[model samples]
Target chain A: MPHTVNCQIDHLSVNIQPGATILEAARSIHIQIPTLCYHSDLCVAGNCRLCMVEQVGADRLLPACATPVTEGMEILTNSQKVRHARKVMLELLMSEHRSDCTHCYKNGRCELQNLASEYLVQDGRFIDLVPFKNYTIDDLSPSIIKDDAKCIRCQRCVRTCAEIQAVSALAVAHKGAEMKISTFFDLPMAEVVCTNCGQCVTHCPTGALVEKNYIDAVWQAMDDDARHVVVQTAPAVRIALGEALGLEPGQIVTGKMVAALRRLGFDSVLDTDFSADLTIIEEGHELLQRLREVIRDKNPQVKLPMTTSCSPGWIKFLEHLYPDLLPHLSTAKSPQQMFGALAKTYYARRIGMDAKNMVSVSVMPCTAKKFEAARPEMCASGFRDVDYVLTTRELAMMIRQAGIDFLSLPDDEFDSIMGQSSGAGVIFGATGGVMEAALRTVYEVVTGREVPFDGLNIVPVRGLEQVKEAALTISSPLPEWGFLDGVTLKTCVVHGLAGAREVMKKVADGSCDYHFIEIMACPGGCLGGGGQPMPVSDHVREMRARAIYRDDAGKAIRKSHENPDVVKLYEDFLKEPLGHLSHQLLHTHYVARKRY
Target chain B: MNGLRELVSALAQKHGTRRESLLPILQGIQAHEHYLSDDAMVEVARALDLSTAQVYGTATFYSFLVTRPQGRHVIRLCRTITCVMHGKNQLLKELETLLKVRVGETTADGLFTLLETNCLGQCHQGPAILIDDEPYTRLTPERIRVIVAEYQQKAALESENSGLINS
Candidate 1:
């Protein structure tokens, strides 16, 4: 058992764990201490001194976020001296910050602005240093925009990139007053090894980093009479879009979101979950073909342990860091791209509308999807496959702009022909959902039985573990797939690029053997994506994951192959999985990139 | 570029490739090449398994580690209070005129570069200037002229010897 330490904070006695920081102890007792640099997901930086508290009998005030709790320690959290120090710290931070709050994109949501308002730091006690510093704005990347003038130099983005993602695309570049987070050689983010993950954008406490929104472009597309605007919502957006509005985390707002989109003048309200089901069909068959080639034909050149390619961030990461292992990645396009390609060709032909007159838009819980849509190779439909990609936050902004009362809005169903999905598609928001979905179909195809689990849950690989592994022994397989029928198919599931890096290292060193691997760049899969709601933590991620599973459990159809619309799609158009048309539209290739 | 890669590899071999050895490796490169070129920093970053921005950040934190090209001879005039009080401006003007280049600039022939630095611990001997790590104290216009001429002569002689060897 861990030792306990007793401490008195503002005359409230509490017993906390020995290693807990003073900030944690205060939070346990509901004593809210304002902090600027402190985040629940990052390490203690202690640079921002806004959390300084007065310790009895100590000459200097201790930073509450960095100092540990001690036995019988008397701490005054909101004393006169502490309050003065915090106020002065807020004033100094505002002096350096560009205080054009109304013009900023994150005016009300910015942490520094909120603290300044709370402390009543309206008086200009210090000179504004923003005008003097040579701050530059880098808006070159399609995914993220970085404004140095609004930065507080908290290093939260730097830590998020390095610790969680293992991609140190951003780093502290200089010292003292000149110190700022910069890319390699201060190059533009698009030219460097950055994956455009947008984790940095979500972690930034100020307006320094943010997603490049396409709200105006979407609005213009909708307003144009010549263009038919069709929007598809990703599965993850439904679980977390409510958080940006007034609803709590884990609220399912799918029907409400569809209603708001319809009200906002979208020509057709579709679902990316439909394409997610299509992906499982194609990817599952591809996996089975590889298994047959390796096991039955004894092929040496064919790569085993194929990794999923649904995440654009993970795709870019592999292209940069592990370029030699490019063959291991599956060639199937992401669900959004699949939907985009189909919207222009298959959906356009069915609706009797010219392909050129249709505009494809997607609402995703990711920023990298913007970069993915803009790739040179994504124009497979003879035009730009996806004209615009909006994050979940941007969709909420559009809803508010349209004056739609999303909270009390009536629930509505998605439009037909391309809007239907299954429970497997709904669970794609969580970490291990893809692997679980694939097994549910593949096992039934091979053994002609449901997955050997209670209610087809696949419990072992369902939660937020960094890396999970599972194996199943094939028995009594159908005659076509019976290659001894005793092989134990091995699989691995990993979320967050750091865990993916570890698994890739093992794959690189030829140490591990697995048939399939699922990798997502952001933590907790797409539900905790970089473009999700702000103030993301492990608790919020867990709530979102629970909501995804709940949605999956409540669905009538629980398997992707059983999704009726997908069955109709294959029968009417594509003919079969990995057919010629599927290869041309639903699959793509990757390019190797420089490591630096 | 290949030579720079080899030099960085040699430095890494001697100093080890840990993060703490970054400073010594960078200093070694600057000591040999007279400046930390972009290619040199890139090589060091590769050797130490660090990002190029991190290497550039460390290289730029110190005033002594030059990140740009420099001439064969660098003249660092002290810009401290005591040196300024004791006619350092006149010394600077004399050097600029003699080298035909302003402060922080190299000459046309790339023979001399002039720059200003913080105190060199020679306040007692005011108006001190360091020429390629060699200090000259109590400078004047005539003294600055003689010192620059000596450096010019040394360069000429060394180039002549190299020319003879090539022939």
Candidate 2:
């Protein structure tokens, strides 16, 4: 059934879809309405009166952004009266806002900049500069740069941080025009538990929030001859790195990227996918052991629900939002951590080199990895395993600085032992890839049969949806295995901190009970990480997501339990999943932070 | 002895509920508790399928909510950029003199606990102070004593009434 929404605009007929908003309809028909305190992604705050439009026979003009298109609604978007009101609103906002965009990082890309250009406001008629009496610029957080001078109080970054990523890292502290964003305390960003996911940066229309790029740090590492620098690339980095090279979003440049890294003086170029497979090996066994405990004991006291701990952003969210469920999180170090720990220990030792001589660097699509590397417990090899973390964009900058042609480089291969990876490892770049990878192994281990689905593509858990859930039944007859039939395996996957928060609330409240859950702190998984290329688009997310799938399809081994190298690591070195060595190296605990 | 809770309870009783309802009747107990404790929140939840967890979740999630009991004199300092630019440091120095405690520490008298908040949403106030739930704009060290005295006087008056009611 097609529902027509009639928006009567000065006696002219306008038709819209059932759920289309008046602001959206006005936009489609090229209606010019001024808005100062309204953003498309943010919730309708209705604080600024910029987008106020006059409705026929009404005493007051309604906010176009907040007002939905209703039948028989007559709106005058561009009347002289509306324009006057909008101009006054903009003038008032300008009086309060710091007009320093010329030297600001968000100079050309600012929404306020575009609006000022459209409004053609030469000067502020009002001088209502509210001076803040007390405050300091908190530069504690490692990955985000916050400048409150240019804040418009739109609350877009706050909402993006809280609602989109479920971090609640930023919030409106005071009331009225005096309202400003803040963390737990007036602590520096570095001191706070911000995952630095950069979703806030992407959502922020101004330069108030930006990434803390480590391009200079990487350059220093490369320049040092005594430091044997090794760089490993995450799967999602290749797809979005081109954006930093002035290529269109979603342009694939894997070959060019490797060549560029080589030119940048990395002694050994490795792949993070290799360690991703290593994670699968350890994590997959952990899941199998948990399943065995469930089957053998038949006790509800057993921790049935084991959540995936691949994403540091998700891990921090759980700590803050749902601290009680910390034990449920798999104690496996993330693939990046595993790679770093091994690069300093196993790789360095195998190559007959000292750990101090090797400078391990990771090119990731995640900002959380930066914070993760800094954790006091992550120094597994008695040193900061990863010395420096570079975003995909930062790597592109390095390539550009090297004067290397990024678009025409030859394809290259990673180094021998740590370079080998499987399709399961590559899929870890996407949201549900971790869940699917774990399932391929656990399903086979428990049932002792091949995965019924071809390609092991668990369709139910796939895609860029905010939350994905699926329930599967463990097949019949394992009397020798002491397992029961028709055991429903309920699993839920949440991507984006906001969506993860929603599911977390249910879990925290003991509602929507599920046996397993997967959470990624960034939207669209690692492909949309804070470390990904700037000015991320839907096209880039799609391309990177596709690249992950392609990498998965190209590999011969698609299951973590099937990786012979991983099997050998456990057999020879680690001994078992919950072994003393595995726990020592791979697992760690979390402490509940006091917000007060 | 302190009379803040008793005063609030008497105020609530005068309005139409028991003194126990003062936490809810006053500016929600969240302002005093950091987050509403299970016992306190359950009392609020009894009226509404709202389990203890639901109430706890809301109380814990929001920054404004105080789930734990706060000190007698709660000083919420705005440490965000707006306040910083407005000489918040001077105000903090004054607060330290008045309370004899640093930010994030409670006074020896147990009368005040100084806390630095992200933003008070009072950016227009520049440096602002929230003494309990009431916000004072454009604050300075000189103005702290007067604000404290005003609240203290009211608390004293309320305590006299609480004694009469109990008697």
| Tens-place lDDT digits, model 2, residues B49-105 | 122333443455455566556567678899998899998999888888877788878
Please give, for residues B75-162, the per-residue lDDT of candidate 1 as tens digits.
9999999999989999998888888899899999998889998999999988999988899999888988998888889889999999
List DockQ, one per candidate, in order. 0.61, 0.07
Off by over 4 Å in 1: B135-141
Clashing pairs in 1: none
lDDT of 1 at A500: 96
Docking class of 1: medium
Writing each residue's lDDT as its tens digit, candidate 1 over A1-596 gives 54799999999998998999999999999999999888898899999999999999898999999999999899999889999999999988888888899999997889998898888886768999988999999999999999999999899988888889988888887778888888877888998878888999888999999999999999999999999999999999999999999888999999999999999999999999999998889898889988998999999988989999999999999999899999999999999999999999888988898999999999999999999999999988998999999999999888987888899999999998899999999888889999998889889988899989899999988888899999988999999999829989899999999899999999888899999999999999999899898889999999999999999999999999999989988988999998999999999999999877
Docking class for model 2 is: incorrect
DockQ of 2: 0.07
